[model samples]
Each structure stands twice: as structure tokens, then as C-alpha cells.
Target chain A: MTHPPLRSEAAELHLSHQPAPEDLERPGRRQLSPADAALMEQKVRKVEVAISLVLRVGVLVSVLVIAVGLGLMFAHHRAYLPLQGDFSYRQLTSGTTPFPHSMASLARALARGDGRGVVVLGVLVLILTPVLRVAVGVVSFLYEHDLPMALVTLYVLAVLVGSFLLAGV
Target chain B: MTPIDFVVSLALVSVAAGVLGSLVGLGGGVVIVPVLTLLYHVDIRLAIGASIVSVIATSSGAAAAYVRERMTNLRAGMFLEVATTTGAVSGAYLTTVLPTQALFVLFGVVLAYSSFATFRRRHTDQPLTVSNDRIANYFDLHGSYYDPAEKREISYKVVGTRPGLALMYVAGLVSALLGIGSGALKVPAMDSAMHLPMKVSSATSNFMIGVTAAASAGVYFIRGQIDPIIAAPVAAGVLLGATFGARILGRVASTTVRLVFVVVLVVISLEMLQKGIFP
Candidate 1:
């Protein structure tokens, strides 16, 4: 689109008197140049917001579940008796140590409303936070039509998810 | 002590660790691991399992602020994460094969480096001569963010893409093996080699550590290392503390945070070294 010469010249004059780079309070104002770059910036901003929300929610839910479990576990002397000798954390560090069998079993207990199950659910969610973050990244990059970056993030998500498969989960 | 009492004490300690870690920019793992292994007498694997969980918790909890600020470079973080996640998986497996003593020694060495770097800190790195690289271009691993401190937008291009990728692999390996956030190494790699500004490198490093720790966490989880009874309170405490720490960071003087870090890291580093040497 062609602008009138006088209007174009006025726009240039407006730009020339603009604030110095250091005086620009908003970082995006300087960098959000050209039409295409601005669009990319907006998309990336959305992705960041989405990622932050996912993480915050994941942490909040996990903390709540764990708090409930702690209240229950210590409400009486149930979990108190054996905790001394348990200080070495012997029971806490073995493979397939018979906590709730598997994630499915944990879910079942959660349905049953057991304290242990609630705690397990919290842990599971916390662990899955990064997986979810990467999943969002894949979608974010794909939305931007940046295949290399999308694939890059996809590879990371694959490794994270693949470990579960390798672990026989 | 009663289990409740023990758990309470552990949580209190973890809260302190989380505060100091976040304040010192080491995250919580570096502080918690030593406290757990040396003071609590928890097995390294068990302690590591909990530390890794706390790391994820803390990282995720802190993500929202950095992301919204746009200090974190999404494309750069994603590209580097490919290398980090793979390295982390490999390192996690190595933990099963390697002895605990070896981990202690490695942890001590890493802590020493972390301490030295913290003491002689450079919040903004000196720019590298080379300003661009092919892989960086391919992945679009460059970014610009508004720096409120400078009152301007800071734009930078990444360089030494291949070297940065390799260093990231090492960072991932260290993170998995030590159950650390690995920002200590990742920041340097990006700041020095990749030519990212200090803000972007550290912010981006923070993002990658979460994903990398998650990759190793799965293996730890399946192995029954993540005991909810122990992990739940510890993670909760760290998250609470980290959140609080971030809020107060700007008010606290940088010199003070650095002084605290120097003292903490020096003590932790020596303890880990002794444990490794004696064991």
C-alpha cells in the first residue's frame, strides 16, 4: 500500500523523535518489528502463559493432595510409630517397593479415598508437570509452523514419555 | 522421634534449603541433597529421589513468572532440551550402575564449580565475537526480551550451536546424576558459548532443567525411589519457600545473596568432598 508522500514523511518524523532505546520501558516495543515477527512474538507469549498456568496448577494440586495425605497420616499415631527406624529411609528407596502396585492401583485407591493414594496422586501429577510442559511446546511450535523447533521439542517429549515405556509402566 | 515429628523436622529443613537455594540461584537440590545425605542419614538414592522431586516442584512453581516476563527463550530451550533429556535418561540409568560414592565426588566437584562461579558472578556475560551459527539459525535459537533494569529491549543471536549442544548434554548428565537443576552448567554453556544474554541463558536453563529432571524422575519413580511419605512434605516445603524467595528477591541485595551462597556452597562442597573421600 502506498501512503501519501507527506503522510509517510510525517511518520518518519514521528519515529525519529521517539524515545531512546534505553528509554523504552517495554522490551517488546523495540523487538516486535515487521508484521511477521510481531505475530510470532504474540504466539510465543501465549505459549509461555499456557506453560506457566499448567505448571502452577500442577504444583497447586499436588501440594493440596499431599497436605491432605499428611494430615491423615499424622492425625493419629498410625504413621508415627515406625518413623524413627524409617529414618534411614530403607523402605523408601527400592524398586517396586509395594506402595500401591502401579499408577492404576494408585488411582483405584484414590477412588477409595485412601490417604496413601492421595499422596501418590500428588506425586504423579508433580512428576508429569514437565511432560505436560513439553507437550504444550510441541503444540505451540506446530501452531507457529516452525517444524524444526516443533520436532526438536517433540523429540524431548518423546524421550520423557519413552522412559515410562522403557520402565515398563 | 515420632514419624510426624521427623517429617515436620525434615519439612522445616527443606523450607530453609528451598529459601537459600532460590536466593542463591542454585535451586533447592544443591542444598537439600547435602542436608539429607549428611544430616538425615538418608541413602543417597532415596535422598536423590526426593531432591529430584523437589527440583521439579520448584522449577514448575517458578515457571510462570519467567515465562510471562519473556526472559525465557522458548525455541532455544526446546532445541537444547533434546540433548538434555537424552543425557538425563542416560545419566539416570548410570546412577543405578554407579556407586553412591562416585556421585558424592561428582557432586562435590560440581558444587565447587558452582561456588566459584557464584562468588565471581557475572549476571551479564561478555559477548562472544561470533554472533551467529547455522544450527542456531535452523532452530531459530535467538531471542529478545525487555530488560526492566536497562529500560530497553535486549536482543541477541546464538553462536557456537554445536558446542552449546554438547555442553547441554553434559549439563543434563550432571543434573540426572546429582539430582540437580543443572543451571550452573547450562547457564555458562549458553552465556559463554551460545552467546545468549545472562537473563535469557539462566531463564532458559531453568526451563530445560525441569524437563531434564522429569526424564530422570520417571526412572526413579518406577524404581520405587519416590516415596510419597518422604517426598510429599519435602516438595511442599521447597515449593512454598521458592515461591516466597522469588517474591523477595528484588528487595534483597545481590551482595547479600552472594555472600550467603558462598558460605553455604563452601560448607556443602567440603562436606560432600569428605563424604566421597572417606567412603
Candidate 2:
């Protein structure tokens, strides 16, 4: 008897149904028994939920920071005041955009409380969301005792960090 | 244009790009790059920098909802990411060494062919059930998702793990070299080579593209390519649009998704061809 895919199980991992006992015995197939598959799905679902939360929170925070920065720019920066027909950001696009693009410059700009600096910070946060999601994956995989996957996730994190360091160089 | 006019106008355009991108698994960079460079007359480098940020915003924003809905295959996405990130780093290094104009032409031809092939099979939504691949089974890369359009649960197994990784590596390399998320390549790699259902392939591609983009994004950032005044609105708008797009994906049929993706693929291929031939 097959079960209706329960709403509770709707978010479960890859394997959602049970393989017949004989199906598990099929050589080279590596089918997990129904109960074991359920357990694995449960664990995977936990990790997925965590990752979802991380993504949602990261994006929300970054968007909020950007909004605040935009507000600050309009409120304090005369150059950005609305409907100034004489003023155009066209000059900024012509290689004079006053914004931080590197860590050192970002740090300096933040110290000065520049609105562009705040916006850059938010951009950085957006870039880092995927990196943070990978970090969470590493921890969760380890907790699940999936060591090979834990190591795989760790390697990905290393590559991501290495890319950052090399880019700085 | 005035800063206010600039920000609001660009944000509105980015919202459209984000909705289309999130729905099709292509990131907003595809649309953002051309619009910024051609329409806004922004420098190509700064446009690329901003587009990279938009790609991440699309991925993370749409992925947040996709994962929660079980549309994204987490294990498959994570496993494929290893290959893509490595390829991205290597491609970044090779950028100074490779004749990218020729590569652009080559990939354009490849994409044109794929767009044709994808259109031919647009109506097939059947997910494969049997798989003998030890690597896929060992990694538990198989998955199932509830399709609201079909009103049924779809279960599928992954095959061709090694081939899928190879294709993803190439996709990542192209993305890094071109400064766009190559989800056009990624979706086919997953759907054709790995036999993931079309929706699964799209959602999983959405999940994976961010890491690939993020790898190159750091390099773009440090090179002073990213202009915050521009990138800020692009990111915010893409995120909002992606969130909205993710809601629509569940209700849309798989064939509709394929049709849309094919159309975008054709356009991108033509643009790529024009870039190579002209430049």
C-alpha cells in the first residue's frame, strides 16, 4: 500500500517512497529500505530548512541595508537630490563613481559614514549569502555523519575563500 | 539622468529581468549586462560588475523559496557546485590566457543547437525512474517534488553524474569568462545529461548558479568594477522580482517553462554571436 505524499513529508529529500524489499537486494542499485530512507529524508529536510532560512534572512538584511543607504543618499547628499536637471549620475558612470570596491577601501569609506559605503556593504552581503549557505551546509553535513559530503562541502568553502583571497592579491 | 531617475528606472528594468531569469533559471546578468552597456551606455566592466550582483540576488532570493518548497534538489546542487566553483576559479585564471572571442563564437553555436534540441522536446515532462549509477546512488542525488501544475508528486533518479559534472564545469568556466551566470548551459546539463525533471533541473540550476557567480564576483569587486550606486538598486530589484517569480514557478507547467527557456536561449545565442562576430 502506497501512502499519499503527506504534507509533512512534502519537503522531504530526494527519496520520497519505499523501494520493495527485493528491490533493495538488487545488486549495485544501493536502494535504502523504506524506514532508512525516511530517516535520511528527515535529516536532509532539516538541512534544507536551515539553508532556506539563511537565504531568506541574508537577502532580507541586505535589501534593507541597501534601502537605508539609498535613503541616506537622498537625504544627505546634495548631488543625489531629486529632479536636478543639471545633475546627472552620467558623470559617475564615466569612471568617477564614488564607491568602495575593495575591502580596504570599503573599510575606509564605512569609517567616513558615506552612503555609497553603506550601499557597498549591502552589495557585499548579497555576494556573501551563497558563501554563508555553503558554510551552513558543511556544519549540517557533519552533524548528519555524512563525512564524505561534509568534506566535499568543506572543499567548496575552501575554494570560495581561496577565490576571495586570490582576487585581493 | 538624475540619480533618482537613474535608480528608479534601472530598478524597474531589473525587476523584469529578475522575474524572467528566476523563472527560467537564467540569472538577471543575461539581461542586465546588455541593458546597462547598450541602453544606459555604462562601461562594460561596471555593467558586468553590477550584473554579477544581480545574479546572486536572483539565485539567493529564488532559492530561498525553492528549497523550502522542496523544488530544489539540495544534494545534487551541492555536489555539482564543487565542479562549478573549481571551474570558475580556473576560468578566472585562464581569462588572461584565452582568446575569449573565439570561445564566445563556439559557445554561441553550441547554445543555438541546444535551443533547437530543447524546443523539440518541450512537451516531455516525464521523469526517469531507473538508475544504475553508483556515484549518484551513493551520493543520494535522487529527489522528488510536488508539482502543483500537474497536481501530483514527481519522483526521479539521477544518472550520468560524471557527465553532468563535466558539463557543469564547462558551464562554470564560461560563466566566469563571460561574466554571466551560464544557466543556459546548466539547465541542459541537468535535464538532458542527468535526467532530472525539467522543473527540478531549473530549480537546481537556480540553486547552483549563485556559487559559480560568487566565485567570480569577488574578483570583480576587488578590481573596482562594482559601482554601488548602480549595483544597489539592481540587487534590490532583482531580489524582489525573484521572490515573486518563485511563487509563479509552482503553478506553471513544465512545458511552459521549457518554452520560455528556449526563447531566451535563442536570444542569448544570437547576442553572443553578434558579440563575437562584431568584436
Candidate 3:
């Protein structure tokens, strides 16, 4: 549970004459020379930068997916017309006919003016978003060597599962 | 309920909700529910169900940016979620079984409380406390952020862990019963109690409220309360609105924004109280 004490040049200058905690450790902690400490900080910074880059990419991908999905939905809805297709306008409008229960039902509902289809699609997007968000979070935790947050992500999934089961939404 | 009519309405509502919800930081549920029930004459239960879906959309859209910036404390959010989800389930069940008048009364009271809380003075400059959590250290929960105002990297530890988490449980319960996003309470608990920075706490609260809503939304869905006709516009509106809000977050003076939010909350609270007392 011990962590390496974080030190910056300013902090180091303030303690130039004083011994570090590592100097007072029981087993005589291995002291990193100033050069080594600087190297370590550089490595941490590199890792941080790399992690940030990956997260940025992830955000972009998520946004793209959502945008495409919404676009397709809009296009399809606008193209749908009554009397041109076999399905009557009545069938399209009255969402309660319980049309074949499948993706077709969703599609038909959307065509028929059942706004619920849009909602279902919206929910799908919502679900995907958290997955992407947690993925990015996972990468960040990995870079930070934060196993607890990583584990907590798994726990979040469990909460998701429990919520699904208990709320049955 | 015709398909063509439904599609057009759904699209329009979705777009509106998305734009407005994004602007206000609410998933647009607050606005959507009233619109559906009062304007469209949809049932309240159905409107709530639709509103729930929109909450999910708003959170999902916004959570990623927050996560990437490391503004969301994943551990704190997940830990508090256990309480929220459980409470949400109970609240959902209560919503189904409670008398309409009683539910309205409770909802009104909660809305009023939330409105008052929103306008209250917020303490944002509190120093962070060191956490004694072995797991926190093992996981490197402590971190530093660049404070633009201070022009320094401020490092901090997560603290008041137990109390903060306990509060989330209550937050979840309220979220479920009321069907309102619980960010108002969750943000304060994390920032004021757990000692997270204001921005981080707000982002984390946003991340957590979705799961809370999902827990209850599922229940409503199963009960056949989720009329997609109603849900479609609500979700679409919220998603659009939340995204817009995220973009503008950094552009405005936060204090002014907060004051406006408080004023809105007060107005909404009074409306709810009037509805309950009169109805």
C-alpha cells in the first residue's frame, strides 16, 4: 500500500539539506540520485501523455458512432412515406398493432410515427457511451497504475447488472 | 400514434431535448416529462419512463469527455453506485405502488428541497484531506490537477469516504423515487464531503446519475410503462441538449451560470409545490 513519494524540483530545493523519508527507512531505502529522479519524472510524463492521446482518440470514435447513428435514423425517417409502401399509413401510425417483435418492429414503428423507436435507438446510444467512457477510464487507470479504479470499473459493471436485474428496465 | 406522425414528432422532440438538455446539464427529463404529460396528454408514468431513457443518453454523451480529462473519480462513482442502484430499485417499485397523490406530494417536497439546495452557497476552496484507504494507495487514487487560476498543480487525496458513499445511497433512492437526475446532491456530496474539486465532482456526479436512472428505468420498462412514442422525443432532446451544454461549460462564468441554475430550480420547485397542493 506504500507509494513512492512524489517530488518536484521546487519541493526538492526546499528539502536540499533535509534527509528524504527514504533516507530514514528501516532497511535504508535505495536513494535515487537527482538524475534518476528526473528520468523517472520524464517517464511518468510520457506515460501520461500517451494515455491522454488514447483517451482523445476514444472520445473521437464515440462521437463519430453517435453522429452516424443519428444521421441514419434521420435519413430513414425522412424517406419513409405513406401509400408508397405496402404498409398503410394507419399501420405505421398505430404503434400498438404489435407488428413482428424484432428490429423490424422498431423500424416499422419509426416509419409509422411511433417516436418510441427513436427513444429505443437513443437508449442504445446511451448504453454504448458508458462502455466507451469506461474503456477510456480503464486506460487512464492503467497508465496511473491505479488498480483500484480499474477494479472499481468492474464493480460499476456489476452495478449495471444489478440495476438491470432489480429495476428490470 | 401513426408511424409517420410519430417519426416526425420524435425527431423534433429528440432534437429539441438534445439541444436544451445539453445546454442545461439536465438530460432534458425535467422539461420532457411535463411536455409529454401536459401537452401531449400522455400518462405520467409513461412520461417518466421516457424521461429515464433521455437521462441515460445525456450522461453517456457527456461522461467520456469527463473521463478523459480525469475529472471523474471512477472509484468514488462506482462505490456510491451500489447505494444508488439499490435505492433506485426500491424507489421504482414505490412509484408503481404508491398512491398518485402521495407520490406527487413526495415529489413536490423533494423538488422544493433540491431547489433550495441548488441556490445555497457552495464552498469550493476547501483543502483536500489525505485518505487512509489502503486500496486508494494501492490503486494510486491520489492525483494532481493543473489549477488554471492558481497556476499550480494541486494534488489531493479522497476523503470522508464513508459518509460520502452513504450519502450516495440516499441520492440513488431519491433519483429512483422522483425520476429526477440526482446530480444536484451527488455533486455536493463529492465536492463538499469527499473533498474532490468542484469540476471533478460535477463530472463524476454526471457519470453516476445515469446508472442510478438505469436501475429505475429498467423497472419502469418491464412494467410496460415505457411508451416508446413518449420516450423517443424525450431521449433525443436530452442527448442533444447535454452535448450542447458540455461544449459551453468552459465558455461561461461559472458563478453566473450557477446563479441562473438556482433561479430555475426555485421556479421549478414552486411549480411542483403548486401542482401537488392544487392537484
Candidate 4:
């Protein structure tokens, strides 16, 4: 069955029509009005370039974040290795023994001097990542005139607030 | 086993569990609990605590990308969370008071049922539309996404809002009590009952599970169940696996993934039953 082309008359929307197979094989052939063809070509090129940039940036950022988080964790683990005592996993689970004087133990001991700050930092990081993600989504929605996404962002903000109050965070 | 040996062994098991769980989409708790109880002989309560923390780590890592993509229904997630949070707190309390063996048997049954549900074929021929719901209308709970396969925009509404939210409460409670990530229940409630598309339901479920885990994780931390050595490896492994899984989700074949998930759950359920009855 042949399907009709989708058209919206609610607004004068410019959409690029797909080239027929015959036209596609013949590289320079054009079957559209000059103005329409020019507009389509321009719009297509712009979107292609924009999408390429977005993908590149996204990959770069993801790699950088993963690398940094891994680096920090590894460095901390290495520093603690030397101080570790004859601590065995069995003793840890049994709960009758104290942890050996390892670097992790030292870090925990130091943190105990200022445990509140570490907890607060952990909570802040937890809260901020989601907020940043939602902010980016909201901006994208506003650009696209997508009210639903904006509303979702607002709802998330509300939830965060409610959770904070309820949990007394 | 000594404390050091226990921590090291638990870490190794957690890493294996995380890798397997990510592959199957059930999360690591299913694997962790059995490994701890049957292999390492850790108390069930302590196993539950460690599993919950790992759940939070996995969910948090996965949710970041979903939120960025605008696929996660943040409103739907939060609104449903009101019910889930309440359920989680209640469930945590109940876990402390209830009989442990009974809870384990009940959890195994739920896992078996969920595994079957996941294997069922999905119906995607239905058009997206809003059902009559005052709450949904008031909240403007409607969204559309571009379906690449259909090459069209599909709009959908939030239906059966109240029932779906109520179900999430139960899901949360069960998750806390059983130490299983509740995504299995949350995804179905949103997808089938609330009329959300499957992809959106999955992403939103991923986002919400972290919050539920965190509520209980805090309590576990206070109770000193979070041994740093055990928690560190579990958290790191789960975070890595979840992030990898989320990245591949859009490219994977849906049916194949679901089938794998079902098989894994069936195995886990049988293991749980065997341990409960024999041990």
C-alpha cells in the first residue's frame, strides 16, 4: 500500500523531500524549485554539521570524566596499601576485630575528625549530578518548544526538594 | 575467615556479580545475596545492606546518561517516588521485624514471576494517547518521542496514574526488604499500566531506583554494614557495569536482551529456592 506524505498545515514548515532513486543516481539532477532546493540543501548541511559536533563533544566529555574518577580512586587505593595490616576479609565480616592500620583506615580516621564535611560533599555530588543533567535537558526542551520535558525537569526539582526535607538531608 | 579475607572475598564476588548483573539487566543484588549467604556465610541482613549500596551506585551511574538524553520521565519518576519512598521506609522497618526465611521465600517467588513477565512479547501497535485521569491532566503528563524505526513522532499519556504510583510503593518496599533492585516491577507499572513506552519506562525506572536505594543505604551506613573494602569494590564495579550497559542499550536488540534477562532470573530463583530449603 502507498502511504501519503506527512504534511502539517498548522504552520508553514520547511521539510526536505527525499530524492527519487533516479535523481539520487544522477548526482546533479534537481526536481525542485530553485528556492526550495537551496533551502533544503542549506538546512541539511547545517543539521549534519551540528549533529557531528554534538557527538564528538559528548564522547570527549564522557571519556574525561571516567578517566578522572578512576584515577582518583586508584591513587587513593595505592596510598593506603602500604599501611594495611594483616587484615583479612574474614575478620572484617566477623565484626569482632578492628581494621588494620591501612591507608583506607587512616583516611577514615582522618575523615572522622571532619566526617560531616565528607558526608556533605558526598551528598552534594549526588545531588548536583542529577540537577546538572536536568538543567541540560530543560535547555534542550526550551530550544525545541517541548513543554513536556520542561515540566519533567520542574517535577524532578520538586522531588529533590521534597526528598531533602523528608529525609532531613 | 578473617576480617581482611572476608573483605577481599566479598569484593571479588561483588565484581563478578556486577558484571553478570549488568549483562542481564537485573542488577547485582540478585547475585550478591546468594554469594554472601551460600558461599561466604555472611549474615543475610549484612548482605542486604551491601546489596542496597551497590544498587544505589549502579542506578546513579546509569541515570546520569538517561537524564541527559531527556528520555527519562523525571516527573513520572518523582510522582511515583512519593509512593516508593513511603514503601521503602515501611519495608526497611518490616525487614528488621519480620522472619528472615519467609522474606527470602517470598522474594524468590517474586523473582520467578518477574522473570516470566520479562520474557513476554511486547505489543507496540497501539497508538499513544492519554487516558482519562484527573491527576495526569492536572500535571500535564504527556510527551512524545521520535521513533526511528517508524520515522515518526509518537505521543503518549500517563494513564492509570494512581494505580501505577501505588504499585511503586510496593515495589520499593520489596526492593528494600529483599535487596533486589526494584526496576523489574517499576518498569512494568510504568510501561503496561501507566501507558509509557518501554524505553521511557526503563530509563525512568533506572533513575528512580537510586533514590529508593539511597534511603535504605543511609540507614545501612548508620548501622555500620558498609565495610569500606567490600563497598568500594562493589560500588566501583557496579558503576562501571551499569554505565557500560546504559551505553549499549540503544543499540541492542530488545527481545534478545529481555530473553537473556529472563534466563538469568530463572537461574537465580532456583538457586535461592535450593539454598532456602536445603541450607
Clashes of each: 2, 1, 31, 18
**Candidate 3 stretches greater than 4 Å from native:** A1-122, A131-147, A165-169, B1-25, B94-118, B122-158, B271-276
Ranked candidates, highest TM-score first:
2, 1, 3, 4
For model 3, residues B139-176, the per-residue Cα lDDT tens digits are 44455555434446666666555555556666676667
What is the TM-score of each candidate's chain B when compared with the real chain B? 0.81, 0.98, 0.78, 0.81
Best TM-score among the predictions, by candidate number:
2
> What's the true lDDT of residue B153 in model 2?
87
Residue-wise C-alpha lDDT for candidate 1, range B1-279, written one tens digit per residue: 555665778788778766665544456787777777777666677778888887776677666666777877878888988888888878867877777677677667766765665455445344332333556655656678776555667677666666667767877876776565666567656654566765566557667777888887767776667777678778888888777655444344434545675676677668768878996
Report lDDT (CA) for all predictions.
Answer: 0.69, 0.84, 0.55, 0.55
- Listed in order, the DockQ scores are 0.23, 0.32, 0.16, 0.06
Model 4, B68-96: lDDT tens digits are 54456655776677677677777767876
Candidate 3, A1-169: lDDT as tens digits: 0011111212322322232232222233356599976875565455445533553454345344434444554566554445245443344323352322234565786676544455454454454445444455556556656466666666655655665666433
TM values, all candidates: 0.80, 0.92, 0.67, 0.64
How far out, in Å, is residue B206 in model 1? Answer: 1.8
Candidate 2: fraction of native contacts reproduced: 0.60
Scored against the true structure, residue B74 in model 2 reaches a CA lDDT of 83
Tens-digit per-residue lDDT, A1-169, candidate 4: 0011001110101111111232222234345599975875454344324432443343334334433433443454443333355533544455542322233443575465432223223323432343344445455545545466456655554544444445433
Output the lDDT of residue B186, model 1.
71
